[model samples]
Target: GNEYPEDLAALPPQIIIGAQYVQAAGVALGFKKKGAKNVAYTYTGDGGTSQGDFYEGINFAGAYQAPAIFVVQNNGYAISVPRAVQTAAPTLAQKGLAAGIPGIQVDGMDALAVYLVMSEARKYSVEGNGPVLIETLTYRFGPHTLSGDDPHRYRTADEEAEWEKKDPLVRLRTYLDEKGLWSEEQEEAYIEEVNEQINEAMKKTEQAPKQKVSEYLQNVFVETPPTLEEQIAKFAAKEEA
Candidate 1:
Protein backbone atom coordinates (compact mmCIF):
# COMPACT_ATOMS: atom_id res chain seq x y z
CA GLY A 1 0.00 0.00 0.00
CA ASN A 2 1.12 3.59 -0.69
CA GLU A 3 1.16 6.48 1.74
CA TYR A 4 -0.68 9.55 0.52
CA PRO A 5 -0.41 10.06 -3.27
CA GLU A 6 2.67 8.96 -5.20
CA ASP A 7 2.63 12.29 -7.10
CA LEU A 8 2.81 14.21 -3.74
CA ALA A 9 0.62 17.06 -5.02
CA ALA A 10 -0.59 17.73 -1.47
CA LEU A 11 2.89 18.25 0.03
CA PRO A 12 4.28 21.45 -1.45
CA PRO A 13 8.00 22.27 -1.54
CA GLN A 14 9.47 23.71 1.68
CA ILE A 15 12.84 25.36 2.29
CA ILE A 16 14.06 24.91 5.87
CA ILE A 17 17.73 24.25 6.31
CA GLY A 18 19.43 22.14 9.03
CA ALA A 19 16.28 21.72 11.14
CA GLN A 20 14.24 20.07 8.38
CA TYR A 21 15.27 16.53 9.32
CA VAL A 22 14.36 17.17 12.94
CA GLN A 23 10.84 18.12 11.91
CA ALA A 24 10.61 15.15 9.57
CA ALA A 25 11.71 12.74 12.32
CA GLY A 26 9.03 14.09 14.61
CA VAL A 27 6.36 13.54 11.96
CA ALA A 28 7.57 10.02 11.29
CA LEU A 29 7.56 9.25 15.00
CA GLY A 30 4.03 10.63 15.24
CA PHE A 31 2.84 8.41 12.39
CA LYS A 32 4.49 5.30 13.80
CA LYS A 33 3.26 5.95 17.33
CA LYS A 34 -0.29 6.19 15.97
CA GLY A 35 0.15 2.96 14.01
CA ALA A 36 -0.05 4.63 10.58
CA LYS A 37 1.23 2.24 7.89
CA ASN A 38 3.62 4.45 5.90
CA VAL A 39 7.27 5.23 5.26
CA ALA A 40 8.63 8.71 6.08
CA TYR A 41 11.90 10.10 4.73
CA THR A 42 13.90 13.33 4.54
CA TYR A 43 16.99 14.50 2.65
CA THR A 44 19.97 16.62 3.68
CA GLY A 45 23.27 17.53 2.05
CA ASP A 46 26.72 16.52 3.32
CA GLY A 47 27.27 19.86 5.08
CA GLY A 48 23.89 19.71 6.82
CA THR A 49 25.03 16.51 8.54
CA SER A 50 27.44 18.61 10.56
CA GLN A 51 24.57 20.49 12.19
CA GLY A 52 23.65 19.38 15.74
CA ASP A 53 19.95 19.19 14.91
CA PHE A 54 20.68 16.43 12.41
CA TYR A 55 22.07 14.11 15.08
CA GLU A 56 19.36 15.03 17.59
CA GLY A 57 16.61 14.14 15.09
CA ILE A 58 18.10 10.80 14.13
CA ASN A 59 18.81 9.92 17.73
CA PHE A 60 15.18 10.58 18.69
CA ALA A 61 13.88 8.39 15.88
CA GLY A 62 16.26 5.53 16.66
CA ALA A 63 15.43 5.67 20.38
CA TYR A 64 11.71 5.24 19.72
CA GLN A 65 12.21 2.84 16.77
CA ALA A 66 10.36 5.34 14.54
CA PRO A 67 10.07 4.59 10.83
CA ALA A 68 12.11 7.33 9.16
CA ILE A 69 14.59 7.23 6.30
CA PHE A 70 17.40 9.78 6.44
CA VAL A 71 19.08 10.34 3.09
CA VAL A 72 22.33 12.28 2.85
CA GLN A 73 23.52 13.29 -0.61
CA ASN A 74 27.25 13.10 0.11
CA ASN A 75 28.54 15.02 -2.85
CA GLY A 76 32.38 15.17 -2.63
CA TYR A 77 32.32 18.75 -1.37
CA ALA A 78 29.94 20.61 0.90
CA ILE A 79 30.06 24.16 -0.38
CA SER A 80 33.77 25.13 -0.24
CA VAL A 81 34.83 22.43 2.24
CA PRO A 82 35.75 18.95 1.07
CA ARG A 83 34.13 15.91 2.71
CA ALA A 84 37.45 15.05 4.36
CA VAL A 85 37.45 18.34 6.29
CA GLN A 86 33.82 17.83 7.38
CA THR A 87 34.62 14.69 9.37
CA ALA A 88 37.38 12.17 9.91
CA ALA A 89 35.01 9.24 9.31
CA PRO A 90 35.45 7.24 6.11
CA THR A 91 31.78 7.45 5.27
CA LEU A 92 28.80 9.46 6.51
CA ALA A 93 26.66 6.33 6.53
CA GLN A 94 28.41 5.00 9.64
CA LYS A 95 27.25 7.99 11.70
CA GLY A 96 23.81 6.38 12.06
CA LEU A 97 25.28 3.34 13.84
CA ALA A 98 25.78 5.39 17.02
CA ALA A 99 22.00 5.92 17.11
CA GLY A 100 21.15 2.28 16.45
CA ILE A 101 20.08 2.89 12.84
CA PRO A 102 21.14 0.71 9.93
CA GLY A 103 23.07 2.73 7.34
CA ILE A 104 23.74 1.93 3.69
CA GLN A 105 25.73 3.58 0.90
CA VAL A 106 24.83 3.80 -2.80
CA ASP A 107 26.10 5.24 -6.06
CA GLY A 108 24.06 8.39 -6.43
CA MET A 109 25.20 8.96 -10.01
CA ASP A 110 23.28 5.86 -11.03
CA ALA A 111 19.54 6.58 -10.90
CA LEU A 112 18.71 2.89 -10.95
CA ALA A 113 20.93 2.22 -7.95
CA VAL A 114 19.30 5.03 -6.02
CA TYR A 115 15.84 3.62 -6.84
CA LEU A 116 16.79 0.14 -5.64
CA VAL A 117 18.25 1.42 -2.36
CA MET A 118 15.18 3.64 -1.67
CA SER A 119 12.82 0.76 -2.43
CA GLU A 120 14.40 -1.43 0.25
CA ALA A 121 14.81 1.43 2.74
CA ARG A 122 11.06 2.12 2.54
CA LYS A 123 10.18 -1.52 3.14
CA TYR A 124 12.50 -1.84 6.16
CA SER A 125 11.18 1.34 7.79
CA VAL A 126 7.49 0.65 7.08
CA GLU A 127 7.63 -2.71 8.83
CA GLY A 128 7.53 -0.87 12.22
CA ASN A 129 11.20 -1.59 12.76
CA GLY A 130 13.13 1.69 12.90
CA PRO A 131 14.79 4.42 10.86
CA VAL A 132 17.37 3.76 8.12
CA LEU A 133 20.19 6.06 7.02
CA ILE A 134 21.36 6.23 3.39
CA GLU A 135 24.54 7.96 2.28
CA THR A 136 24.78 8.68 -1.45
CA LEU A 137 28.23 9.09 -2.98
CA THR A 138 27.78 11.73 -5.67
CA TYR A 139 29.26 14.92 -7.01
CA ARG A 140 27.88 18.42 -7.46
CA PHE A 141 28.86 19.50 -10.99
CA GLY A 142 27.94 23.17 -10.55
CA PRO A 143 28.37 25.86 -7.92
CA HIS A 144 26.91 25.20 -4.44
CA THR A 145 24.13 27.67 -4.93
CA LEU A 146 23.05 30.78 -6.93
CA SER A 147 25.67 32.57 -4.78
CA GLY A 148 28.05 32.62 -7.77
CA ASP A 149 30.75 30.41 -6.31
CA ASP A 150 33.54 29.57 -8.75
CA PRO A 151 34.13 25.81 -8.26
CA HIS A 152 37.44 26.10 -10.13
CA ARG A 153 38.92 27.69 -6.98
CA TYR A 154 38.76 24.38 -5.08
CA ARG A 155 38.61 21.69 -7.80
CA THR A 156 40.67 21.18 -10.95
CA ALA A 157 39.51 20.82 -14.58
CA ASP A 158 40.92 17.29 -14.69
CA GLU A 159 38.81 16.21 -11.71
CA GLU A 160 35.72 17.78 -13.29
CA ALA A 161 36.29 15.88 -16.53
CA GLU A 162 36.69 12.62 -14.58
CA TRP A 163 33.25 13.05 -12.99
CA GLU A 164 31.74 14.17 -16.27
CA LYS A 165 32.27 10.65 -17.61
CA LYS A 166 29.83 9.37 -14.97
CA ASP A 167 27.04 11.79 -15.86
CA PRO A 168 23.78 9.89 -15.17
CA LEU A 169 21.66 11.42 -17.93
CA VAL A 170 24.38 10.89 -20.54
CA ARG A 171 24.92 7.29 -19.47
CA LEU A 172 21.21 6.55 -19.36
CA ARG A 173 20.64 8.10 -22.80
CA THR A 174 23.54 6.15 -24.24
CA TYR A 175 22.16 2.87 -22.88
CA LEU A 176 18.68 3.68 -24.18
CA ASP A 177 20.03 4.55 -27.64
CA GLU A 178 21.97 1.27 -27.79
CA LYS A 179 18.78 -0.64 -27.02
CA GLY A 180 16.83 1.41 -29.65
CA LEU A 181 14.62 2.79 -26.89
CA TRP A 182 15.50 6.46 -27.36
CA SER A 183 16.42 8.86 -30.16
CA GLU A 184 17.91 12.36 -30.37
CA GLU A 185 14.74 13.57 -32.10
CA GLN A 186 12.62 12.44 -29.12
CA GLU A 187 14.94 14.22 -26.69
CA GLU A 188 14.88 17.46 -28.70
CA ALA A 189 11.08 17.56 -28.96
CA TYR A 190 10.71 16.70 -25.27
CA ILE A 191 13.08 19.49 -24.25
CA GLU A 192 11.31 22.04 -26.45
CA GLU A 193 7.85 21.15 -25.08
CA VAL A 194 9.13 21.16 -21.48
CA ASN A 195 10.68 24.62 -21.94
CA GLU A 196 7.43 26.01 -23.37
CA GLN A 197 5.41 24.60 -20.49
CA ILE A 198 7.86 26.05 -17.94
CA ASN A 199 7.64 29.49 -19.60
CA GLU A 200 3.82 29.42 -19.42
CA ALA A 201 3.96 28.39 -15.77
CA MET A 202 6.31 31.29 -14.96
CA LYS A 203 4.02 33.76 -16.69
CA LYS A 204 0.98 32.49 -14.81
CA THR A 205 2.74 32.73 -11.43
CA GLU A 206 3.94 36.27 -12.23
CA GLN A 207 0.32 37.31 -12.80
CA ALA A 208 -0.76 35.92 -9.39
CA PRO A 209 -1.36 38.32 -6.48
CA LYS A 210 1.28 38.83 -3.82
CA GLN A 211 0.78 37.14 -0.41
CA LYS A 212 0.77 38.93 2.93
CA VAL A 213 2.29 37.62 6.19
CA SER A 214 -1.02 38.31 7.96
CA GLU A 215 -2.84 35.75 5.81
CA TYR A 216 -0.54 33.02 7.15
CA LEU A 217 -0.87 34.27 10.73
CA GLN A 218 -4.68 34.42 10.52
CA ASN A 219 -4.89 30.82 9.36
CA VAL A 220 -3.23 29.55 12.55
CA PHE A 221 -5.87 30.63 15.03
CA VAL A 222 -9.63 30.00 14.77
CA GLU A 223 -10.26 33.43 16.39
CA THR A 224 -7.55 36.01 15.91
CA PRO A 225 -6.25 37.58 19.13
CA PRO A 226 -6.12 41.36 19.54
CA THR A 227 -2.32 41.29 19.64
CA LEU A 228 -2.15 39.38 16.35
CA GLU A 229 -4.69 41.81 14.83
CA GLU A 230 -2.56 44.74 15.93
CA GLN A 231 0.56 43.03 14.59
CA ILE A 232 -1.14 42.45 11.26
CA ALA A 233 -2.12 46.12 11.04
CA LYS A 234 1.46 47.11 11.83
CA PHE A 235 2.74 44.78 9.10
CA ALA A 236 0.30 46.33 6.61
CA ALA A 237 1.48 49.85 7.51
CA LYS A 238 5.13 48.84 7.06
CA GLU A 239 4.36 47.37 3.63
CA GLU A 240 2.68 50.65 2.52
CA ALA A 241 5.77 52.59 3.57
Candidate 2:
Protein backbone atom coordinates (compact mmCIF):
# COMPACT_ATOMS: atom_id res chain seq x y z
CA GLY A 1 0.00 0.00 0.00
CA ASN A 2 3.04 2.22 0.27
CA GLU A 3 3.38 4.01 -3.03
CA TYR A 4 4.36 7.40 -4.47
CA PRO A 5 2.80 9.64 -7.07
CA GLU A 6 4.74 10.82 -10.08
CA ASP A 7 2.52 13.85 -10.59
CA LEU A 8 1.01 16.08 -7.88
CA ALA A 9 -1.28 18.22 -10.06
CA ALA A 10 -3.02 15.25 -11.65
CA LEU A 11 -4.36 13.92 -8.35
CA PRO A 12 -7.77 14.77 -6.89
CA PRO A 13 -7.88 18.05 -4.94
CA GLN A 14 -8.39 16.28 -1.63
CA ILE A 15 -5.47 13.98 -2.34
CA ILE A 16 -3.10 16.77 -3.29
CA ILE A 17 -1.40 16.35 0.11
CA GLY A 18 -0.07 13.07 -1.29
CA ALA A 19 -1.35 9.53 -0.88
CA GLN A 20 -1.73 9.41 2.89
CA TYR A 21 -3.62 12.70 3.08
CA VAL A 22 -5.78 11.79 0.12
CA GLN A 23 -6.67 8.42 1.62
CA ALA A 24 -7.60 9.99 4.97
CA ALA A 25 -9.80 12.71 3.45
CA GLY A 26 -11.41 10.19 1.10
CA VAL A 27 -12.36 7.98 4.03
CA ALA A 28 -13.84 10.96 5.86
CA LEU A 29 -15.77 12.14 2.83
CA GLY A 30 -17.06 8.65 2.22
CA PHE A 31 -18.37 8.48 5.76
CA LYS A 32 -20.08 11.83 5.33
CA LYS A 33 -21.70 10.86 2.03
CA LYS A 34 -22.77 7.44 3.30
CA GLY A 35 -24.88 9.16 5.98
CA ALA A 36 -22.87 7.38 8.62
CA LYS A 37 -23.54 8.48 12.20
CA ASN A 38 -19.79 8.35 12.89
CA VAL A 39 -16.86 10.46 11.85
CA ALA A 40 -14.22 9.37 9.37
CA TYR A 41 -10.53 9.81 10.27
CA THR A 42 -7.18 9.94 8.51
CA TYR A 43 -3.60 10.78 9.52
CA THR A 44 -0.55 12.24 7.82
CA GLY A 45 2.85 13.60 8.80
CA ASP A 46 3.84 17.21 9.55
CA GLY A 47 5.73 17.36 6.28
CA GLY A 48 2.61 16.39 4.38
CA THR A 49 0.51 19.01 6.20
CA SER A 50 2.85 21.64 4.73
CA GLN A 51 1.57 20.96 1.23
CA GLY A 52 -0.93 23.50 -0.21
CA ASP A 53 -3.43 20.74 -1.01
CA PHE A 54 -3.50 19.78 2.66
CA TYR A 55 -4.96 23.16 3.62
CA GLU A 56 -7.39 23.23 0.70
CA GLY A 57 -8.69 19.75 1.54
CA ILE A 58 -9.24 20.61 5.19
CA ASN A 59 -10.82 23.94 4.30
CA PHE A 60 -13.34 22.30 2.01
CA ALA A 61 -14.17 19.68 4.62
CA GLY A 62 -14.63 22.35 7.29
CA ALA A 63 -16.74 24.62 5.09
CA TYR A 64 -19.08 21.75 4.24
CA GLN A 65 -19.04 20.38 7.81
CA ALA A 66 -17.89 17.04 6.52
CA PRO A 67 -17.62 14.74 9.53
CA ALA A 68 -13.88 14.27 9.21
CA ILE A 69 -10.93 14.07 11.60
CA PHE A 70 -7.55 15.19 10.31
CA VAL A 71 -4.57 14.05 12.37
CA VAL A 72 -1.07 15.40 11.89
CA GLN A 73 1.79 13.26 13.12
CA ASN A 74 4.29 16.02 13.82
CA ASN A 75 7.52 14.18 14.44
CA GLY A 76 9.70 17.33 14.38
CA TYR A 77 11.17 16.66 10.92
CA ALA A 78 9.59 16.13 7.52
CA ILE A 79 12.29 13.82 6.31
CA SER A 80 15.39 16.08 6.57
CA VAL A 81 13.36 19.31 6.77
CA PRO A 82 12.73 20.55 10.31
CA ARG A 83 9.26 21.64 11.46
CA ALA A 84 10.43 25.22 11.88
CA VAL A 85 11.40 25.28 8.22
CA GLN A 86 8.09 23.70 7.15
CA THR A 87 5.82 26.46 8.41
CA ALA A 88 5.74 29.68 10.44
CA ALA A 89 2.78 28.64 12.61
CA PRO A 90 3.52 27.75 16.24
CA THR A 91 1.62 24.49 15.79
CA LEU A 92 0.24 22.42 12.90
CA ALA A 93 -3.17 22.16 14.60
CA GLN A 94 -3.52 25.96 14.52
CA LYS A 95 -3.60 25.80 10.73
CA GLY A 96 -7.00 24.12 11.02
CA LEU A 97 -8.36 27.16 12.87
CA ALA A 98 -7.76 29.31 9.81
CA ALA A 99 -10.30 27.10 8.01
CA GLY A 100 -12.85 27.45 10.85
CA ILE A 101 -12.07 24.06 12.35
CA PRO A 102 -11.09 23.15 15.91
CA GLY A 103 -7.56 21.80 16.36
CA ILE A 104 -5.91 20.12 19.34
CA GLN A 105 -2.28 19.36 20.05
CA VAL A 106 -1.65 16.10 21.92
CA ASP A 107 1.33 14.10 23.12
CA GLY A 108 1.62 11.47 20.38
CA MET A 109 4.01 9.43 22.50
CA ASP A 110 1.14 8.70 24.85
CA ALA A 111 -1.09 6.11 23.17
CA LEU A 112 -3.95 6.47 25.69
CA ALA A 113 -3.93 10.24 25.34
CA VAL A 114 -4.03 10.07 21.56
CA TYR A 115 -6.81 7.48 21.61
CA LEU A 116 -8.88 9.54 24.04
CA VAL A 117 -8.54 12.69 21.97
CA MET A 118 -9.45 10.84 18.78
CA SER A 119 -12.43 9.18 20.47
CA GLU A 120 -13.84 12.51 21.65
CA ALA A 121 -13.25 14.13 18.27
CA ARG A 122 -15.08 11.28 16.55
CA LYS A 123 -18.01 11.67 18.94
CA TYR A 124 -18.24 15.36 18.15
CA SER A 125 -18.20 14.73 14.39
CA VAL A 126 -20.81 11.99 14.66
CA GLU A 127 -23.09 14.52 16.38
CA GLY A 128 -22.97 16.71 13.22
CA ASN A 129 -20.02 18.80 14.37
CA GLY A 130 -17.64 19.99 11.68
CA PRO A 131 -14.11 18.69 11.10
CA VAL A 132 -11.50 18.62 13.91
CA LEU A 133 -7.71 18.60 13.70
CA ILE A 134 -5.39 16.71 16.02
CA GLU A 135 -1.65 17.36 15.96
CA THR A 136 0.40 14.64 17.60
CA LEU A 137 3.90 15.44 18.87
CA THR A 138 6.22 12.50 18.34
CA TYR A 139 9.57 11.45 16.85
CA ARG A 140 10.69 8.90 14.29
CA PHE A 141 13.14 6.27 15.47
CA GLY A 142 14.62 5.38 12.09
CA PRO A 143 15.97 7.22 9.07
CA HIS A 144 13.34 9.02 6.99
CA THR A 145 13.34 6.05 4.65
CA LEU A 146 15.26 2.81 4.31
CA SER A 147 17.72 4.61 2.01
CA GLY A 148 18.11 8.29 2.79
CA ASP A 149 20.12 10.95 4.63
CA ASP A 150 21.34 10.36 8.14
CA PRO A 151 19.43 12.22 10.89
CA HIS A 152 22.60 12.92 12.84
CA ARG A 153 23.47 15.70 10.40
CA TYR A 154 20.47 17.77 11.47
CA ARG A 155 20.01 16.52 15.04
CA THR A 156 22.73 16.29 17.65
CA ALA A 157 23.52 13.04 19.39
CA ASP A 158 22.26 14.47 22.69
CA GLU A 159 18.88 15.35 21.17
CA GLU A 160 18.43 11.88 19.69
CA ALA A 161 19.47 10.29 22.99
CA GLU A 162 16.83 12.32 24.81
CA TRP A 163 14.12 11.35 22.30
CA GLU A 164 15.12 7.69 22.61
CA LYS A 165 14.37 7.92 26.31
CA LYS A 166 10.88 9.13 25.42
CA ASP A 167 10.24 6.54 22.69
CA PRO A 168 6.55 5.56 22.36
CA LEU A 169 7.30 1.86 22.16
CA VAL A 170 9.44 2.04 25.28
CA ARG A 171 6.83 4.10 27.10
CA LEU A 172 4.01 1.75 26.13
CA ARG A 173 6.04 -1.31 27.04
CA THR A 174 6.85 0.24 30.40
CA TYR A 175 3.19 0.93 31.05
CA LEU A 176 2.24 -2.60 30.09
CA ASP A 177 5.02 -3.98 32.27
CA GLU A 178 3.74 -1.95 35.18
CA LYS A 179 0.30 -3.49 34.65
CA GLY A 180 1.92 -6.94 34.77
CA LEU A 181 0.81 -7.60 31.18
CA TRP A 182 4.33 -7.61 29.78
CA SER A 183 7.74 -8.97 30.78
CA GLU A 184 11.13 -9.84 29.24
CA GLU A 185 9.90 -13.31 28.43
CA GLN A 186 6.78 -11.97 26.78
CA GLU A 187 8.77 -9.48 24.74
CA GLU A 188 11.17 -12.19 23.54
CA ALA A 189 8.31 -14.49 22.63
CA TYR A 190 6.52 -11.78 20.66
CA ILE A 191 9.67 -10.85 18.78
CA GLU A 192 10.39 -14.49 17.97
CA GLU A 193 6.85 -15.06 16.70
CA VAL A 194 6.97 -11.93 14.55
CA ASN A 195 10.35 -12.88 13.10
CA GLU A 196 9.11 -16.34 12.18
CA GLN A 197 6.06 -14.91 10.46
CA ILE A 198 8.16 -12.41 8.54
CA ASN A 199 10.54 -15.11 7.39
CA GLU A 200 7.71 -17.31 6.21
CA ALA A 201 6.13 -14.46 4.27
CA MET A 202 9.45 -13.55 2.68
CA LYS A 203 9.96 -17.15 1.59
CA LYS A 204 6.53 -17.25 -0.02
CA THR A 205 7.12 -13.96 -1.80
CA GLU A 206 10.44 -15.15 -3.16
CA GLN A 207 8.87 -18.31 -4.51
CA ALA A 208 6.14 -16.39 -6.35
CA PRO A 209 6.43 -16.20 -10.12
CA LYS A 210 8.07 -13.20 -11.69
CA GLN A 211 5.70 -11.00 -13.67
CA LYS A 212 5.68 -11.49 -17.45
CA VAL A 213 7.03 -8.80 -19.76
CA SER A 214 3.50 -8.12 -21.06
CA GLU A 215 2.13 -7.52 -17.57
CA TYR A 216 3.24 -3.88 -17.55
CA LEU A 217 0.87 -3.13 -20.43
CA GLN A 218 -2.13 -4.82 -18.85
CA ASN A 219 -3.34 -2.26 -16.28
CA VAL A 220 -2.78 1.01 -18.15
CA PHE A 221 -6.31 1.17 -19.49
CA VAL A 222 -9.70 -0.47 -19.09
CA GLU A 223 -10.57 -0.16 -22.81
CA THR A 224 -7.32 0.68 -24.53
CA PRO A 225 -7.37 3.86 -26.57
CA PRO A 226 -5.79 3.96 -30.02
CA THR A 227 -2.67 5.73 -28.78
CA LEU A 228 -2.20 3.26 -25.95
CA GLU A 229 -2.84 0.38 -28.32
CA GLU A 230 -0.09 1.69 -30.57
CA GLN A 231 2.29 1.95 -27.68
CA ILE A 232 1.43 -1.53 -26.51
CA ALA A 233 2.00 -2.91 -29.98
CA LYS A 234 5.37 -1.17 -30.14
CA PHE A 235 6.33 -2.62 -26.78
CA ALA A 236 5.24 -6.07 -27.84
CA ALA A 237 7.21 -5.81 -31.07
CA LYS A 238 10.31 -4.72 -29.17
CA GLU A 239 9.93 -7.65 -26.82
CA GLU A 240 9.65 -10.04 -29.72
CA ALA A 241 12.79 -8.57 -31.28
Say which candidate scores most in lDDT: 1
Candidate 2 clash pair list: none
lDDT digits (tens) for residues 44-142 of candidate 1? 999988889889989999998888899999988888899999998899999999999998999998888999999999898998889999999888999
For 1-241, candidate 2 gives per-residue lDDT tens digits of 2122222112232333434454455555656666656565677899988787678778878877887888899999988899999899999999988989999999998988998999899888878788899999999887887786798888888888888888888889989999999999989999999999999999998997655445455544558788878877887887779
Candidate 2, residue 208: the lDDT equals 71
Q: What is the lDDT of residue 76 in candidate 1?
A: 83
- State which candidate has the highest TM-score: 1
* Regions of model 1 farther than 4 Å from truth: 3-16, 192-241
TM-score of 1: 0.77
TM-score of each: 0.77, 0.71
